[model samples]
Target: MTSKSGRRVLVADDDEAVRRVVHRHLEDAGYRVESVPSGVEALARLRGAERPDALVTDLQMPGLDGLALLMEAKRLDPALPAIVITAHGSVETAVDAMRKGAYDYVEKPFHKDVLLLTIERALLHRMVLEENLRLTEALAREFSLGNLVGGCAAMQEVFRLAGRAAPTEAPILLLGESGTGKELLARALHYNSARAGKPFVTVNVAAIPESLVESELFGVVKGAFTGAVASRTGLFQQADGGTLFLDEIGEMRIDLQAKLLRTLESGDFRPVGSEREEHADVRIIAATNRDLGTAVEDGAFRRDLYHRIAVVVLRIPPLRDRIEDLPLLLRHFLGKLGAAGLEISSDAMKHLADWHWPGNVRELENELRRAILLRGSTGSIQPGDLSPEIQAGRPPRGRGDGRLDLRAIEIPDEGLNLSDLEREVISKALQKTGGNQTRAAALVGITRQTLIYRMEKHGLK
Candidate 1:
């Protein structure tokens, strides 16, 4: 076989003749080979300078056996694939080797071709594992608290609240629009908390039909109902000792809400068909864009459950309310798209900032991604590159009368978001009144305390 140079394989066996033959075969296969007399020597080499791509160790060694060596090798590099060379024809030993995470195994009298193939497979497995690690690390860094891009006061406060809530096991209620990144924040909370290494299961209450909501959350037994052929584990059990994020939780039926409340209060739930109660140690984090407070008052949601899941509430400001972060978010998306060097024209930036992002950050990201794909190799983005809705959102050619003309305001076909419109009007009122809170409150026909709360909610000065 032609040598595969630069690929290193470490061989550990007490037999000198075996080592010599194996070394010769690997070297001829274009691999750099290192032979060690025992598992201890192999470990020292692995820990010392260079690391091998794969290990070939004998099942029986003097000081450390092949199984022990494999465990240590995994501790050093979990991605490293190892092959066990077992001279013994014992099936138990082979099973033990496999149990200890052996990539592949060969008998002592194995053919050279078989050994070479096993080594090649091990190397390929290692490469895949390394690539997965790189991607996982990249994603972790991308969503890390420090890496989340936003400098506006509202965003800063959100970050602060998330940081404080991360280390605790309290249920967090995330309030925001559909595309406002509630799930991302839920993940951040999970990965930052003590449950970081545990499962982070999600259930979109709105997506599931009302009939299946309970079964999906609480699992089912064999013959639980029609089409129930086998016992099934529910999301609650799957998220045991971790986090369970219920998205659009307000859409859950009131009857299901009571069952969910029971789970939250006691961590106990019964499957749809089973009379026995099971326990799951899961931390709940519920999110919704609807006014859950109103839902509770309207008898659409259970009042007790509302208060139970909302141990720590975080209201994510809509994109329009925190428009100051638009530039940063645009740049963030550009960087994520591998277009960090691309610049947006001032007019384009203004257009992006001025438009009410009903879909919030998700929409912004999609727009940037679409823009990048559509405008290939373009040096920069201009106003015309934006969507028609964004372009038409700009205030029309003014009367030039210097006087404020509401008639010139151009509303898009999607119509104005009443919440956004109200926020902007209040903001403009505050701006026009030179930061006089009382006068601004009076002009908006709201109580001073109500105005103060709105200002704080919008993160306005």
Candidate 2:
């Protein structure tokens, strides 16, 4: 017998001998057993603060019979597992108890081993239900809109639009640069909508080969093509009554776009090599980094198909466009990567904020992960810890006058340390003028005396 030392079981029967025998058997099997002489007492135990993990009760008790007791226990805690004990020939009563939510049934004149095994199975069922509920709640919190992490106006607008469109069934079109979190937003929409309990399926149009794209989306019957051995369910059926997110939708072949358009319009699709048309009520959310309007004009995409899926369009801004959210993004990624305690040096943060992230949020997360690894025993991140491309910051943009444009500098909403800014400006000016204090002061548009005073105040050479 497996050691069930911590599990509690409640035994209820009108026969005092049966209750005593069951209590002793379960205690011998390492269960913390509670014995009650009647069904009414079992119901009282279930309503107590310390409810039992599993209940084993007799079906033919005099008052408040086992069926009624089982129903009340379930009402108190729907996940509580119960086992019914019926007379040897009372199979119908046992089946009725099962239909009303008993986990399993044990016939009277039952072997002690059989009763113990039934209780074990019921406890196991309770455990599985608890675990599934835990996972579902975790996913709900992880995909909640409040977890998206954004403070910039552009990002806030994206959040607003997504919230407004999430509960609707209208097909959505997500347009953004690569790595701008189109798939993440799609998941948030699905998990927050009416179809949260159903599956949220995803397919990358650009990743699949052109030859298999059609079958991949609409499924294939056995022997539909060469090397076909069994039927395959496609994304549409898999995401039935939920969501189907197509990433990089612009990469789909023009010929296949017509078929996709037909399914979107009529909710009917035929599997390959099958004459019968199957229907799936799937909500489509398609994303693309490419400009579909331009693709339509260039004959690279079907204009009619484009019109079908663009019911609600969302444009996720790139990282460079929403640099104000960098601090929040950094904190979010750090917490997620289990490096929340690590600090970022001012110089390192400046480089991160200045870089024009071509790969957007995904790339930023990768860079931070790499920095944490390279930081070794250090508790903080420095510029040297980052990738060479990031450490270089953004390349300088020059004007016709050949002077750097200080006006273009982006100040984060939280602002910066004025002393740090002054020191950096003085140091750069001195470097440009080759350590000549007079020319450096002139370049900085400050008097030589004031520049020297400020340089001394900042402890700059």
Which candidate number maximizes TM-score? 2
How many clashes (backbone atoms < 3 Å, residues ≥3 apart in a chain or on different chains) does model 2 have? 0
TM-score of each: 0.63, 0.67
lDDT accuracy of residue 177 in candidate 2: 80
- Summed backbone clashes in each candidate are 5, 0
Model 2, span 17-127: residue lDDT tens: 888888999999899999888888999999999999888899988889999999999999999999988888899989999999999998778899898888887887788
Error of 2 at 318 (Å): 1.4
Error of 2 at 201 (Å): 3.8
Off by over 4 Å in 1: 1-5, 17-31, 86-121, 167-171, 190-203, 214-244, 254-285, 293-312, 330-461
**lDDT value for model 1:** 0.83
Worst 10 residues of 1 by lDDT: 394-403
- Can you tell me which runs of candidate 2 are displaced by over 4 Å? 1-3, 13-24, 37-39, 58-65, 86-99, 107-111, 163-173, 190-200, 214-222, 230-244, 250-285, 292-313, 334-351, 372-386, 389-461
lDDT of each residue in 94-120, candidate 1, tens digit only: 778888799878987889999999998
Give the alpha-carbon lDDT of every model. 0.83, 0.86
